[model samples]
Target chain A: MPIRYPNGQPYSRSPKQGQAKKPLPADTYSGRGMTLEQDIDEANLYYLSQQRAVVHKKPTPVQIVKVDYPKRSAAVIREAYFKQASTTDYNGVYRGAYIDFEAKETKNKTSFPLKNIHPHQVDHMREVSKHGGICFVLIRFFQSAEVFLLDAKHLIDYYDNQDVRKSIKKTEIERLGHQVKTGLHPPIDYLRTLDAVYFNGDAKERT
Target chain B: MPIRYPNGQPYSRSPKQGQAKKPLPADTYSGRGMTLEQDIDEANLYYLSQQRAVVHKKPTPVQIVKVDYPKRSAAVIREAYFKQASTTDYNGVYRGAYIDFEAKETKNKTSFPLKNIHPHQVDHMREVSKHGGICFVLIRFFQSAEVFLLDAKHLIDYYDNQDVRKSIKKTEIERLGHQVKTGLHPPIDYLRTLDAVYFNGDAKERT
Candidate 1:
């Protein structure tokens, strides 16, 4: 299907349904055709065209060790390694405020494991917030296909007491988060929720 | 040889140097075993670890068509196409101010070609500056092993009259930018220039 925004600009889309199915693994999002990366990318494009806010996922860090150059056309990275990131996945400017966030998905339905998040990520989010930025997490429960926007301050609070509480219950997330229904063009449009919960309220209290 | 910082932190020499050289096409940094991507990555890490600033290369936008996962542990991207980016390469926060920039290198020693930078990148830099963020380009003339910090406003001015002015000459950049000497550890520490230019300037003129 041709995806066109309200402004008449042709929008880009990932491979649909069976076109990308060359699957060998069950849990890999890439095997499922449209990875979360693609969805978020499309979401950013939609946000940009509409002048909503600027958000982007930082690239995965890779440490390269060896390269073999016989012919100078396509350099092949012979040896490389992945490095863990200390910050959240997504960040940008929204309505004159800096926005920072991490995104995650879990197959389990019982609860969202805080273990999936790193302490360094918590520290990074805290730093962003301390510098006066909007920070949060976009969590998706795969089975239910339900997405939630949880504030970073809340996540930081739980993280500080995580040793005692163990994990954040799914029920608690459902209670605190603003539910985001996935859309067609931009599959995950969570910024709309930000407008209501953060902007509509008193700015001083939210900040 | 081992590298050490002034602060006594043991430093790993350029990870790019460790990679085996591969045959890549002419005008491709990848042919030498290191691409533009790796240089920016190293720069970002250096900026972060030193508490200087947070800057990262935006991910290479890819349109993934097919993926093959041979195992549950790894997902192989079988077929993907590159997409043009809408914004500059790097952006982040530093010392209570937002930072945005693009890094480009040219093999040409005489002049930096205008084609190396995209129009949207210039537009994005303009918007970033209007938003009160520090923005610029980190240009490296690889042949001469020299890097220069050209402010975004200067670039935008030239970019606007590109039809008449054509490319930006090296002498012009030399006159406009502060030269950055590459070191063993972080390689390019341009933050010190920023400290002297933006942060340490008279307080009232800032912002």
Candidate 2:
């Protein structure tokens, strides 16, 4: 028996799954164990503390139906439902640029499924990019602990042409996206990749 | 009997409340009746439709505690609590600039109380401003049907020096902030106010 994605595609293990790898330092933050959201949150906190960026994850949107206010106690939500977000998960200002992105992790090792990216999110990324915001997606391969910063334009292109292929092959992602380095201090240093891709590696030009 | 705020401040009517006012045209959108948040949402929608800007009100932050997954239905959240937001209510991008703001309204005609703002929000705005994002507060005076866009710096200054005055006088807001014009299509034309204040009345400089 093999695990399968919601779309019925069979999951396969990565070729390097059993290969020996270099061990991470004892002090490495998160140590490739935290979820992508947690890693990004840690990085964002570090960024804020250093005054390098002002990014934040939008709170989980919930459709609250009922709440009870008890005497001398805080209101407790009695009924609610999770609501799909209208925009990306993370956004903020960095170096006078509006930065927007969604972070997602895929257990599939061969390719990243298109089903993980919603239509509204693609529309949002397109709109943000059109408005001159730096838009991208942070994709993490859970099994291999590899993260890539794929520009929104590339994802949008592949998403719009999904009839040809329902998923983006790992090779295509490696070719088009910048690999994010994981280390201590701030687990995923995507900003360094952003500097290389968007700002032409010159961070002080705007300053 | 006068209405009172949550802080127990006695609210008073504006001096011109009883004066005869000019009648507005029947086509004015929202007609100064909607809440500040509604007006901003409407304006943001219009801006998006017109490709003028991309702004959105972040959803209310909720802490979801328990969820039940039924056999053939959407998951229902059974226990949750509303959480105070660490940042402002609204943020977006416009004209290659990161825009962040909080919208607040008060029925009191004389002053806008500092107590309406939270310290964490002030800290967030300060961080945003430090990162070169345009940060401000949209204040609405319900009694006068007036909306003013006050730069975050002004509010932060008064907030930090709160020992002198617990509230900012309406006159001070008028002196330091730009009055947002109300009209159809978009109920609040705040981007126009932003143009005058932050962009020096030039909308084409960046383009």
Candidate 3:
């Protein structure tokens, strides 16, 4: 008998069990009505409240081209465009280590396209890695509701090798990435995997 | 002889050199035409361009209430209100260490009012300190044109002891704070002081 959680569902040890974990429409990462980014944002709030980490999604920078100060009313931004972010979406201090990452959800069942990540983002991640910051991607496969935390090095390797291949096959991610176990409290408990990927160092590098 | 850069007047050696270094109207932290926050923002941009650090001021979080999408023009945010930041204004990784701080300038010559900082900011800084991240306040005395990087502990002490005292005196700041030397390039070269307060430990702590 598989171990069951408080919700009475068996621990999802594989993709087959993923559905049992997410019964509601909102629980699905790519349910069209929901998003993986929302799940990560909620998890960040939980971590913040517990004082476990200070991670936050940077606000979308906007370039205000025009504004109007209406009489007796708040100033209205009449026109604006989103500016590209210089760094990853989320970053903060975790147990004295700098944590930084971008989160993306793909509905594809077979592979994650490199196009989902901008070239500048890949460059930014590579630059962050050189600065000794722990950088990774929180990639969720919508088809399986399975999430994986893949180190920036792995992403960069494939990004640079894009001339050879346009997309990273699911098999490579399974081999190179750390599966992030989800929970009811903090839907994405990624930091636990951080300890394994970062501190353990060279041992994991072999894989 | 005043020690200056290759360009001119010797770099004044005294911590008092801080005042002389800031000569331009914009250089003055309290100049009616400019501000200390602007200097930090510019310095941050320089740091980014140089890849010296990955620091950035969090965009002022705005609660966008209404927006209009013009047929051919950019989206217009018709209604929005600034949201209170749960954390400080600036935060990011610097040399593998998490650096977080709030920059404030005061025109009052004798004392920097505690009211300039919010209680929530105090609480957030305290929490950040507990997590081993380097936290501080970049306070500028507009009259003297001197900037100091005071550790969060010093600020917290004054914040929690507010019942006993109202504000931090300039004399106390000069005594307890790390005087940051301003430069023509970075304008406020605070990381120099950061090394003293955070890494050297013994050096600026005695201030």
Candidate 4:
């Protein structure tokens, strides 16, 4: 029988329970069990440890409704619901420039669907770009285990132009976006691409 | 009689339930019902509307342990716990520069206690500053309704110096930090203070 919570409702374990318990292999580049979010988190940690950049993934937004404060214990969140995020998932400072981006992984092989990104997120990326911040989207093709860093300008143009196709073709992405190489130290080394595209291959020169 | 949740646990209202329902006064400078967080949020909204800056408060972090997915409805988080934030509460981009800060309100009349800021936060701020982000803390004296923007450098200096006092004296804060004036539009005009100190009173010039 399924476990029941205090209110008589059945309690269910998270879908990722089995995967979370599984031990990671010695090599992550194989990218078998690791998710794109986890890869980026590991990269961010690596960046922070080296004092290279200060990027972080924002916490998941939740609308907390009820909390229980028991004696001699931490407050327990009894009831809550997830809320849509207003901004991108990741942001940070890189070489005195404000960096912001969203990461998404798709199983499709030929193209990246536009449905993965929301309208508000496009507007936010546009606004961040207008304010002179380095804004982009990191798209990973799960089938090929490849990642690409596409600047927000290209994304905003496609999002705003009604005549264009709904999804961006893999060929077009190759032409417009820079490919991010995976490595052991930092799973996704997108900063190397950023250095070439935005900072003229030398971050110190811009600052 | 109190309401009972599905698990037979009694549901108690949040501590801020009463204040959440109260209407705000027309004049916020009086700050009768407004919290420091609320005032900064209002200011951030104002900044976003004007296309001046893109600052935001990171959402509260929560660890969801159990969730109930009722068919055709949003998933309800039944069991969770609040997690401590790893970084400062607020951060954003302004005039092509990275900005980061934390806000705190003190009811004390003479001094702002140092215990309010955690050691890890100081370390995080130090890391941010080293990475070239404009970092600071917003200290508000609840009794006086006055707010000050203290640079992270000053706070770091005091924190690292073991011989110094435990709290920052109001007079010392007045000497080192710039006073943030309250205005009708943004409520707390911290950007103006930033303009004077960091941007030489002209944000465009720095950009």
Predicted model with the maximum DockQ: 4
RMSD of 4: 7.2
What TM-score should be assigned to candidate 4?
0.84
- Residue A161 local lDDT, model 2: 97
What are the per-residue Cα lDDT tens digits for candidate 1 across A1-207? 788867665554544432443332233234365666677788987986676766667765445455434342223344444445767878777665667788777776867778778888998887777655677888877777788989888888899997788678889999877787688867987877888877886753266
Grade the docking of candidate 3: incorrect
The best-first sequence of candidates by DockQ reads 4, 2, 1, 3
lDDT tens readout by residue for model 4, B67-126: 777665557677777776789999998888889999888888888878778787898898
lDDT tens per residue, model 3, B88-115: 8898777778888999887779888888
Candidate 1, position A69, lDDT: 42
lDDT of each: 0.69, 0.81, 0.75, 0.81
Candidate 3 colliding pairs, count: 5
What does candidate 3's lDDT look like per residue over A147-201, in tens digits? 9999999999999998999888988999999899887769889877887777675
- Structural similarity to truth (TM-score) of each candidate: 0.67, 0.82, 0.79, 0.84
**Lowest summed lDDT window (length 10), candidate 2 chain B:** B19-28
Clashing pairs in 4: A6-B7, A6-B8, A7-B6, A7-B7, A7-B8, A8-B6, A8-B7
Model 2 misses residue A63 by how many Å?
A: 0.9
lDDT value, residue A77 of candidate 2: 74
Chain B TM-score by candidate, in order shown = 0.77, 0.81, 0.80, 0.82
How does chain A of every candidate compare to the true chain A by TM-score?
A: 0.80, 0.81, 0.81, 0.82
State how far residue B131 of model 4 sits from its true place (Å).
1.1
